[model samples]
Target: MSEHPIELSTRMIDTGVVDTPSNRVTEELSELADGVAIVESFSHVVAVRTDDGLVAFDSSGSGSGAQVVEALRRWDDDPVHSIVYTHGHLDHVGGSAAFAADAEDRGRPRPRVVGHERILDRFERYELTSGYNRMINMRQFGGAARSARRLDERPFLPDATLRPDVTYEDHRTETIGGVEIEMHHCEGETDDHTWSYLPGFDMISAGDQFIWNFPNCGNPQKVQRYPVEWAESLRAMAAKGAELFVPAHGLPIAGRDRIRTCLETVATTLEDLVADVIEAMNAGAVLDEILHTVTVPDEALDLPYLQPLYDEPEFVVRNIWRLYGGWYDGNPARLKPAPDATVGAEVVDLAGGIDRVIERARATSTAGDHRLACHLIEFAVAADPSSPAVHEARRAIYAARRGGETSLMAKGIFKSAEADSTTVIDGEAPPLRMIRDLGD
Candidate 1:
């Protein structure tokens, strides 16, 4: 057998350097154990053979659904009898239509789609906010992630979304084709998340819980995430004594010990953040004070799986505050804040003129003060949006900020800003208005 993902992760831990993200979605299928195979895609599709037919966990996304089915056919021709969703995320459930089509073509009935009861509510919410979700996807993903087919774009949660046919509240166990599947409801990335385990196979199909990056509990563009409950779920999975751990997005790990260690490490890091943030919150600390003071230990972050590739810990701090503290942000003036443009104009006026603000912005940027440079550039732009010189400086400053970020979330937003300034300069568009930028 090829080197298991666990072996690679183990070596990475030993070297103290993460070579790549654990959430790569290359479309390929590999079996780490007998009768079980994992298809790596935008989200992984884990196929388990059973006497009744094939039981697949997560069918991949709409873009890779056919590829997932093709890979499974090359390995095992069993008709998919049941497809389990790890959550309501499009990447996790988008491929169910493809699976259903495959079954129909083979003279078999459609596979039963299964997930947590809250998934139904999630689908309803997506339908209600499809327009906003579509816009968010375009900004956040740059390319059309909301569209299933790259060229033929669809709505964010298109009418074609395959809603779950079976739903559970907390925990459920059932025998399918003589093999038992245990599904536990847990909230982490989504309120409707579910992690499944196969007792006989000694494997856990952990949805997005243990993705190789820091738990994406703080995605700025996304809704509220549960860091407190996220840590608890990881601990529960670790106690299962599973020999194989398959995640929906990243590399699947092998060996009971390796699985436990990786899960425990991820759990502890999150638990630590929650504890530190809550303690600060309890002391009546303002969000700004807690944000600047609280930090994840360098050692914990240096671990292979704990790398901040997708979402960093700083955003997580903000999310924790949002969950318990409400949106006031502790700034008295911001509570009933003036327009962003109005505030920027005031800052520029304080600096004497738009020209002075632009000069300082460029100088501060060159002096390795990119953060302050950005604020100054925004002030200059607000004061004189038609200035080509200021726009060029804004583009360069945001590009520099993008270069210094580690997480994809930060990089994308900064890149979006850089691109926006470029558009204003190149197209001679009207003064750039700051919209929520998404990444390419």
Candidate 2:
């Protein structure tokens, strides 16, 4: 098992040292300035001490919340005056209940919860699609069916989520404990993302906008992200010229020039991608053609921070097409196409038989054409799902695909597919696995 909560084969992006410790297990609490400190949890929680009380940005994820609160208490026992959420992502706001509970125990009044008004809508959506979210998350994280089933038994949105008591439209400035925080709302990873700036400290708390890795504007399973506006928001942050930059997911960065370069490079990457896709659209190019043609420059990709470790640029191009072009993929036949199973059956018939199709899939996989291999295997399974030979081959092919994938999202989904094939071969109830001793 990896030491980091989020594991990646790639090396950590090379951002200048801002004093983040190597030991993430201990939750290093680094004091950036006189009254400011950051608790480096899965997602960081920033605490700013003011004359009146403590003002915190993000509570961290569910169980991590209590740990963050304890870390903050160790630094200073000031009552939390307010909690500002950067967005509605569970990791950012799940810990709100812990902060509230700590305040109550200390005999202090409830801290004001502030966020973009759309956060309420996000929570409501989660409630409505709890089952669907669980299934996708299982695929997203490559967890077993038992894990997803456990999640289904509970509420998707935690009861501990402290909804925003105060909401804003575009921007708002609040004075908490004599410290002023300027919150600016913009469309990015989520519609409700807010980037806060503290004039007194010359610091900017960029929610998910400036995470150390590549910008997550192209999550495959998530709702629509704003690439065009995401670029605009980054440009706006670069213009702030803040000395200290605090991101929700990564270590804090100090120095104006380093911060500006990081922000501008990310902005330019998004802007160029958007422009290239838009140009292809104007030429009446189809979705597949656009995806193949539009590309991020090598200079941008070479930037350690802009690496495609989480969400790649290809997914972002598809998102732009979805935003502007709607669901039609410029292919009339697909507008109201037959079900995939029906199409697969027909393809199998034309390809001769299930055995032939499986053979072709293995050859395609060996030849480094995993995408074509997947299509062939899908047809084989759909046409003859009862065939033990086909299922075994399907499992092997999917495992190979998973091994070759770079993005966690792709790997997780491929792993899920491999697991599904294993279930069929083992003759277990769909999604159920037989347990074995560890040493076995």
Candidate 3:
């Protein structure tokens, strides 16, 4: 791997070369300014030395949270005065326990945990939908989902999540260790997102708002994301004229001009997407038509930071429709549609038999129409679940779909489908059962 593994890896995955100047990640503590430093863990943690003590932003992911604390100790042993959570996502806030434990070990006061007021609601929802989150995450991150599971068998959001002791509704300014820190709430990847700015150092800790990849405004497996407001928030941060930009998931950026251009470009890409999507929705375009019509400019997509690595633009279009147009996809037939298996049985009968349907699915996949091939193969599988040929075709089609995907979320979902077909072919237990067992 190259020194900047993420940039090198992305180049290989996106353009088959290592030339683009992508986000740089370093294992050691990197100082962004006089008092600001960052530890690049699974999710980076930002630390600011204040007159009273140290103010930290985020604690990395749960598995690496303790390690992050250790790394920070190596750099500076100032007792943590406060920790600000940018959001309630597991990766950003799941490591609070380690921070708390560190405080106790050092005989220091428990660091005050602060975050958006909606953070409590997010944690409550996570508890309520633990199983669903586990399933979705399994299909979103593939095999790595196993490590994300908590000891309590819940995956993604763990039971150890630390709720904010101090909550702010839209904006809050705190003088921590004599350093003024401003927290501004915005709806982006999560409703409970907070971006912090320090005027003393002219630095912005942008949580996940400026993750190096395309803005993750369209996560297919998760809740609704605010793209319109997300863009607006980025613009707000850009107007701050911060000299150093630090994101929760990627390397820190220095230089005011470089930071401003990056922020504006991301904002413009999302702004264009939201505008096109809302325009199509107002014109009464259906979801499918809207998806085809609203598109991010190819020039924007070509930007290294805007590449679709974690989430794609097409998914964002669907999210926009969902936000504005409701669940009805404008297809009357699907309003009160029959069960998928029942519809598949009808299609299989119309196509003669399962074998014939499988043959056509294989041909379609061979012709590079994997989407249509998967649709046909799904019907064949539903029509005759016991057919080995149908299962083989289903597996092959989904594998092809997985191979063509750019986003990790898309690939994981396709891989899950392929895994299901393999489970049936190998005479193993159902995929859901396996997932449940893994959680246990």
Report the alpha-carbon TM-score of model 1 versus the true structure: 0.92
Q: Which stretches of candidate 1 lie over 4 Å from their true place?
A: 1-6, 14-17, 143-153, 428-440
Model 1 error, position 157 (Å): 1.3
How well does model 3 score by local distance difference test? 0.81
Residue 119 of model 2 has an lDDT of 94
Which scores higher on TM-score, 2 or 3? 3
What overall lDDT goes with each candidate model? 0.82, 0.80, 0.81
Task: List residue ranges in candidate 3 displaced over 4 A.
Answer: 1-27, 143-152, 431-440
Number of clashes in model 2? 0
- Tell me, by TM-score, which candidate is best: 1
**How many clashing residue pairs appear in each of the predictions shown?**
1, 0, 2
Q: After superposition, how far is residue 288 of candidate 1 from its true place, in Å?
A: 1.1
Q: If the candidates were sorted by their lDDT against the true structure, best first, what order would they fall in?
A: 1, 3, 2
Predicted candidate 2 versus true structure: per-residue lDDT over 35-67, tens digit per residue: 988888878898898898888999998879999
| CA shift of 6, model 1, Å | 4.2
